[model samples]
Target: MNVLLQVADTAGAACVFLGAAICLLGVVGMLKLPDVLSRSHAATKPQSLGLLVVLAGVALRLHSVMDLATLALIGFFQLLTGPVASHLVARSAYRTGQVERGDLLFDDLDAQLTEPGQEEGQGRRDSP
Candidate 1:
């Protein structure tokens, strides 16, 4: 039992460390990314996964029922809300035309904007 507990502790620490590293990487990516949408992707995906890993590690290190329940709740909230928040941000950025597509190979939004039937400058309030 003692050895098992020790192993779990080590594993939990490793998981937490790894998660923190991932979150740091995501932060770096966000800073280095050129645009709002790409930065949001970096933030949401890695940030959510890193938090999940940290919560799971906490659950493993905590043997008490209440602690585990709290950890589970944290993980559940992260899982349920993270992607939804990211999607909302992305969609808002898209609709608002705040997203940058500098290196895009093919852009559907560009095509839509250039289509014949679309009104001129419908979303281009800032354009001269």
Candidate 2:
């Protein structure tokens, strides 16, 4: 029983550590990515999943039912919210022309961000 408990503890710790590392990787990727949309994708996908895995590891390590329930709730909420938030942000960025889509690759949002007066649609960020 003791050995089994130790193994469980080790596994949980490993999961948590690995999840954190994955999150850091996502952050690094976001920083290293060339464009805003790409960075947002890095942030919204791998990092969100990494958070979920970390929460699961915490849930595994928790001894109390309440703690487990809380962790599960957090995980559920994150899973539900993360993608929606990402989509909204990405859409807003595309709408506002904040993302750069230059290069000779396939593009879809090209028309949305580029028009005669569309550049001004982003408005003044200097406004108080």
Highest lDDT against the true fold, candidate:
1
Question: How much lDDT does each candidate structure score?
Answer: 0.82, 0.79
**Model 1: per-residue lDDT, tens digit, 2-88?**
999999999999999989998999999999998877888898889989998888787779999989888888878888998898878
Query: Cα RMSD to native, each candidate?
Result: 6.0, 6.0
Q: Relative to the unseen true structure, what is the C-alpha lDDT of residue 96 in candidate 1, on a scale of 0 to 100?
A: 75
lDDT of 1: 0.82
Query: Which window of ten consecutive residues has the lowest lDDT sum in model 1?
Result: 118-127
Please list all clashing residue pairs in model 2, or write none if there are none. none
Question: Model 2, 1-128: lDDT tens per residue?
Answer: 88977877888898899899989999998889987678778988888789988987786677899998898888888889888988888878866678665652766656644645547456433446
User: Which runs in model 1 stand beyond 4 Å of their true positions?
Assistant: 101-128
Q: How displaced is residue 79 in candidate 2, in Å?
A: 1.0
My TM-score estimates for the predictions, one after another, are 0.75, 0.76
Q: Superposing every Cα of model 2 onto the true structure, what RMSD results?
A: 6.0
